[model samples]
Target: MFALLCQLASAFVGAVIPVFYSYKTIKKPSQKSLSYWSKYWTVFGSFLAVDAVLSTLFINYFIPFYEFGKLIFLIWAVCPQTAGAQFVFDKMLAPFIHRHERKMDLYVERMLDSVFTNGPTLALMVN
Candidate 1:
């Protein structure tokens, strides 16, 4: 019961509120709104990735208060007063991404080139 409630709260905070604010941001473009949502989505994506990997690896293990903790974190992240997402992105993610962005871009370009060049061949092989 508690876990289910936590899930509901998390979804509302993490998804519903952002979506509402995102629509508002789209309607009225501003530097502040744009910056906040960008940071929110970046942090949200990072959280999802980490959660997915950890849950997959520890499927059987029980983590006490995980859902509640997640909800609290989401609240903190989305709350404008705290601006946790912005802080996290600026302090952590940005530097790491900046350091390896070139390498990542090169890999992505190579992958895309391969896909475009070998697309027909790959399709034929699949069939």
Candidate 2:
């Protein structure tokens, strides 16, 4: 079925390729490879966050062939010829993140502080 095929494609394009490429980059570091993968990860992470929220809200149900569309996007993101992830990061995500960088950092720091400070208490409460 289309859904199964899409899932397989998604796994390959989204996860397998990235993991392999990341390993290669780690093994042999170069400025070009580091820069490209950094941009790729930034864009990919943004996509995953947005996709999670949309899927949680069932927005995919309204869009026809959402899986196919997602597959195409994943391919575009990772495909060397297009360099879509870098394009997207430079054009969209970078600006947005830069603008909110201070606030986001503050929030993350606060959250981590809370977790570390209250971890034992929280764990006890959970049980």
Candidate 3:
């Protein structure tokens, strides 16, 4: 149960990071006109969240098939899932952006910290 909570939280934060970055640095989206922002993230989150649930079910429910099906699952499940996740990670990472344009240093720092925390914690949880 706790593991499930962690996975969902990490996935949610990971999904939204890029949205925040793009809004903050690249386009400077007006917070008032965030309809597209809300929709984009909703779509992104729903896609990843659904796949995550499906993948978990498929893995646990079909152990024998999971091993043989890893390749198919990688293509059908993991790649898209990870792409959305990475999109969330990559939005603000470019040259010549200023400090004020950064939105807040603490948020970026926490996001980076999440990567470190999630990686090792995920490895430990899985093993």
Candidate 4:
């Protein structure tokens, strides 16, 4: 039960909390900052989408797996350690991101291009 809650919280924190950090890091809302925010949201949203699908499948198919002590491992993702999410992103995920940097960039570019090119319906929802 506790671990289930932890899994839920982990997904929320991983996806939503980064926006706050991005805001804090950017002192001004210049073109660069705005673009940075857009990219940040894009990447985070993509990650969250993938995570939701995977977690749903796992929870549905592997109920017994979550019943054991293995669930404690999720704490690394859920708990905000002293260094915080940025540290984990930089130290853990960044390398993998860099390895696939071109693909990520292409995906973000195509996604943003499509969104901005279309009518402003989705834009309003994002705002």
Candidate 5:
């Protein structure tokens, strides 16, 4: 039961990270930064390769405990799960991000402004 729960959590987290990254980085349809194939495969391939090597070296051989279950977990973690991740990102997370993007940008701008123009610079005011 504990192992199953851990596997599920790992799988879900593995799915979410790429989706969140893509949602945060890529622009909308008109101003898209990466083509569909490029974005999908870039995230998928990178995760897959990393997961493969790590699973092979550590999960499969070095540690040599729960090897079968860990490989199964890795499969669920990597695989073609990106499509589902992207769907979740698009349908859920993307809307929330779009809604708050302006406010977030403004907050960042003000934070940077204070850092660069205020504080000790108060003494340097040249007007």
Candidate 6:
């Protein structure tokens, strides 16, 4: 279960590639329409998708092979499959994350501006 949790968390992190990229590519005014985010997003998503399908098929498609099938898959597919996830995150996910974080900073700034301007005004009126 721990390993499974790790896998899921890692996969989710990998999936964040496009979303972060989407945020990053949009956050910066000068970096508009960059393919870096989209291309890597698609690649990681593809790797994850294909790995899942293959793993499922490997497990169910050959019932006769049973656990033996899984063992073979463990060696041939599992490591690479998960490794691909890590690669996607390390290679593609981190870059976009910075951009997303920039967007978050903007959101926080807007929210703070609103709060600072309105909160004190409301407090004074109430007093």
Q: Write the per-residue lDDT of candidate 3 for residues 8-121, one digit (tens) a residue.
A: 554445445544655574476675335434534544555556667877777535564433343342233223345532343245322213435466577899888998979888
Greater TM-score among 3 and 5 belongs to 5
Better of 4 and 5 by TM-score: 4
Better of 2 and 4 by lDDT: 2
Pick the TM-score winner: 2
lDDT against the true structure, each candidate: 0.91, 0.91, 0.50, 0.57, 0.56, 0.56
How far residue 69's Cα lies from its native spot in candidate 1, in Å, is 1.0
- Of the two candidates 1 and 6, the one with more favorable lDDT, higher being better, is 1
- Every model's Cα RMSD, please? 2.7, 1.3, 15.2, 7.7, 12.6, 14.3
Q: Which regions of candidate 4 are displaced past 4 Å?
A: 1-50, 56-58, 65-71, 78-91, 119-127
Residues 1-127 of candidate 6 have per-residue lDDT tens digits of 5445545555445545346646766787344245444545555566557668877777534455443433343333223344443455567666776669889789999999999989999999999
| Candidate 5 Cα deviation (angstroms), residue 120 | 8.7
The TM-score-based order of candidates, best leading, equals 2, 1, 4, 6, 5, 3
Better of 2 and 5 by lDDT: 2
Q: What ranges in model 3 sit over 4 Å off?
A: 1-17, 25-27, 31-33, 59-127
Model 2 lDDT, full chain set: 0.91
Q: Clash pairs of candidate 1?
A: none
Q: What's the TM-score of every candidate structure?
A: 0.82, 0.92, 0.27, 0.44, 0.33, 0.37
lDDT of 1 by residue, 20-106 (tens): 999999999899999999989999999888888877988325888888888999999999999999998999999988999999899
lDDT of 5 by residue, 41-78 (tens): 44455556766888667664455345445545444434
lDDT of 6 at 11: 49
> Residue 12 in candidate 4 has what lDDT?
54
TM-score of 4: 0.44
* Model 1 residue 94 CA deviation in Å: 0.6
Model 2 misplaced stretches (Cα beyond 4 Å): none
Model 5: lowest-lDDT 10 consecutive positions: 29-38
